[model samples]
Target: MACVAPSSRASPRRFRLTSTAMMESAPTTRAAITAARARSILRAVSGNLDVPGGEPLGYADPIGKILSFNKLEMNEALPPAQRAKQLGADEYPFFGYPGWERNDAANRRLPHDYMHPPWAGQTCVGHARAVLNAMRAGRPYPVKAAISVASNPLLSLADVRKTYEALSSLDLYVVAEYYLTPSAALADYVFPICTTVETTELWHGTDFCVACPSGIQPLYERRNTYDFWRGLAVRLGQKEHWPWENVEQVWDYCLAPVGLTFQKLVEQNGIFGRREYKRYEKLGFGTPSGKVEIRSSIFEALGCAPLPVYREMVLSPQGDPEIYRQYPLVLITGSRFMPMYHSEWRQIQAAREKRPDPLVTLHPETATKLGLKEGDWTRVSTPKGAIRMRLHISDMVDPRMADADHGWWFPERKEAELFDVFESNANILCPDDSELCSPEIGSWPHTALLCRVEKE
Candidate 1:
């Protein structure tokens, strides 16, 4: 979902709708997508569609907008003998869209039928594509295994039920998590992953790099992701492949090229580099053309439009009139918020106190039309399904569209209805149908779909 305002680092200021005094709902009395508004709706997240800008909304747009720079340029120029074809490159060759590094492409390969169509560009084997294909006839991949880390597929992916189906059917589903999340509960094995405070990371920038060391030891058998991988490798008889016993040794090896160790870098307060420009003159552009290709050759070779143009989505109100009639208000999911970091910080008391419920932001006028108040809980339904969210009446959103928090689950209410996952998750209202997916990249619609809201 598109952010109505840019995220501020200064202070996490949020509009608590219940406390707000005045909410004018006049400018958007025409909020419902009935006649004129239907002709000009806020196009959703695929970079293909551009909207008329007012007060700048960001984040969601950037995901697809950057695809024009398709990462194939990073290694596109590699000789065929030195390079290997990436997964889904045959179907969705929007340049490194499969999210596989060039060298690692051969390691993962799906069955022929699964490799064919309904490609999800960046969603990695995609939310639905991977699941659907794995569940397809004749047992393509003999074993279905997923080692989930830093992701809650049940909440993150579209269609909660379908996600459950795929996860349950998996031969071995391993999850690295701190708690027994609804998604983790289904896992065949759950590894306790250490928190950021219990792990080390290099907070690096263009000019300088600094070591952010772990604050405390990993508690109660909790291990970092590195050790987890190493443990797997060791058990699988690939122990020699992982020479380093722990992350510290690995960090030392990484920093050795720069003539520094992690300890040295930390003691020195990190390494600094002089700001340099025009390096392209000395070396060369990292592309097949040796220059930025405004009209990418890779796109042409892969049967995509060479030059960029604002191509309308595969499904539009004009093309899909029947669905629009059923679910009219433009429902945008995956909206970013300050209170939580994409379903992670919900367990934090401070964050929960800041924003208590899953919110569906609607124009004040739109809310009035639908007999909804700022605090009223509403059942938001799309053609796919329905989920409940509180109405956040504000002029921030265009009257014709509604924006809802995407990932919503309550750790406190774990026993209550799948941790109250299905109750308010915006993905519940989103469909994984290939028709609703972006044609060029096959990204399922998280934002562009239509929905209707009602009092719960």
Candidate 2:
């Protein structure tokens, strides 16, 4: 493995993993793996020492194990009836242990699902579309306030129109963000938050951990997320719950029970404890059967399909052939890009230059049929809404398919109307209807949709 800083002005310093023979092809191969997939693979492989490659060596990660173990223990600790009352517990009993007691009397009292305040508890597993719908309809009860973290729902959520209405209806909306994002611009109060570069991070895996110190002091009035939350807790008269005065103190508490301190851990680089492979052989997996279940018992108990299966999407060409004739292209939204994160850093000259405009990548044939030249401004439309993007005619996508970017807003433009978020926003074209979501989490189809491209 070798780290090579790219010569290109747009590319950041990146690490290259290579075998002795494939050094030349390493960069291209690595680039093919999307950032999201790479992260997903890392998460899946973390501490999985049971792989066939070698014997797993190390102690069980006390710090990491305890973090998850605490959640499981507390979940099991919840009172049976109280746990069942949790929204979505009835439908998604695997959400908590008490959910196993489906016949509980208290579970019968509460509705199978809540249309209002849509599952607002420790088990924050509610559908975004459902919650937003409740807020707009004001049925059962009204939702009057919302606190947004580093999220820009207006530009990032499916059905931008509904999100806009729900946010606009809020009596109080607070956003903590690094920039005046399109969502933040509509906030009643927006607090400046420190960036990762200005904030320390405690990076931990299942068996290894590292403490990253902030490289530089926070610029201007920016503060870390902990400080922001702590300050709010104080104002809300819940200061007792937040005893830590600073981020370091919070870190100390986290490490103290593990027989380590932030200072000590930093000195030692990190806690790389012993490895115990095939842990299920002894302690058993954290499942109902105490082993891997090919068919999830939890899902079965909750009346959900025990096995994964594909279902036809409502907005897809296959599902609605009538719409397919109008919108000929298969639209896949939000493919990951290297330079910028979701709807962020577009204002930076360096990053913006790498992708100066929002782009719709399509097959060269599709672009020609649509009368689009390379880099030509074009309108992409679905039944829900439309957005404009520059065309990047490429053979990477199928002849009848296109991939559009997400989370776009012109930071340099007027902030009065959320930087004109609807202009090139991908979510505007997405549907958040109940029929369009999954039965489990109400996950809307963002990747696959029917869209038409027209030269602007």
Candidate 3:
């Protein structure tokens, strides 16, 4: 089904009209009616009883499964290893070079290896190339490693910590920062970077669903990323290697590849350069077959499934029904709010006041049954660790579900300490073994978890 917007300012509404009939109707009047009908249609669709509160329709159903399975079968029909080799050669011509292609090549080498710390694993040869380039240039490390031990992956913070600790053990000097835990305390140097609003840039991304220019100045003299990078480049004696002299130059370069000039983009404020911005269009998908393959022969060559299968995650609430009975509530941790990115906003007084520390949200019915009250501090624990947070009883959560706002650091406490050292981090609760990861993608199950909450 296709939806068309009638007016710019009107709230978006959806209408179910026969495609043939809708096309035959008067354009202007039909648009107005469609806009009005969208509201009513949306209301009717949402009124269905099976729809969970705050959850859109068909969420739990196997929508992606159906699509992926079909693609998988089609790809499996191709000769083994041919598809992988073909895909590797095409789509990303620069895979062997020092650009996005190299990144893709690295990612492809370990498509199922997502369990590593952020940008830590050396997946591709390109990463090695970049590392070598930096080393040869006498450049201070091109990558800064930051660890938020409080809300690492739900699989195993210890494993991540061990891996990073091993990496840090190497002579590499990494710039580090910790949100709520002192994981980054091992770094040679630490610099505090401000929140998004606290800084300014010529934001030119289609993520906000709007093609508008955002012009705002930095709230404070805290160094912006571009300024920092430029300053560092100068310090490294490689100023000329960076074009455009300043951020404006880099911004211009980004737009220069396309027909748009920097001055024109700035003048337009933010032009809707492209109407159809498919977010996942470039997922290493350009095959001669020109189809999204769920079953990749590449994975088959690697003795894996190309299909997107939902393997039961280890230590997850779903994996152990018995654990569900004990814990009762499925916990979703580390989701961010608009005003904060992880734990960055905690330092801002206004933002801190608005959202103080971590909050445990539970269904009101569950809260009542457990003899818990809103605003009461409660402890949530797993086999690995536990932490305490203020409660927010609401129906917004499922009766059998609870969530803890992540990325809070108590400055008064030890830099990285939260709760008790042995029983604090959310990751401590998650099992570190490989069983918690997706066998196919190596993606960790961060969303699904079983936990019990008690009044502290």
Which candidate leads the pack in TM-score? 2
Model 2 spans with C-alpha error above 4 angstroms: 1-49, 54-123
Q: Please, what are the lDDT tens digits per residue for candidate 3 over residues 62-98?
A: 1111111111122224454443332222212222122
Q: Evaluated with lDDT, which candidate comes out highest?
A: 2
| Model 1 CA deviation exceeding 4 Å by range | 1-87, 95-128, 136-139, 314-319
Clashes of 2: 4
lDDT per model, in order? Answer: 0.61, 0.67, 0.45
Can you write out model 1's per-residue Cα lDDT over 230-334, one digit (the tens) per residue?
888899997776888988777676666567777887888876654333333443333355443455455566576665443333334544778777776776787
Worst 10-residue lDDT window for candidate 2 reads 1-10
Residue 225, candidate 1: alpha-carbon lDDT: 91
Task: Estimate the TM-score for candidate 2.
Answer: 0.79
**Using Cα atoms with residue i matched to residue i, what is each candidate's TM-score against the true structure?**
0.73, 0.79, 0.56
Q: List ranges where model 3 is wrong by over 4 Å.
A: 1-186, 192-221, 227-240, 257-260, 274-285, 337-339, 412-428
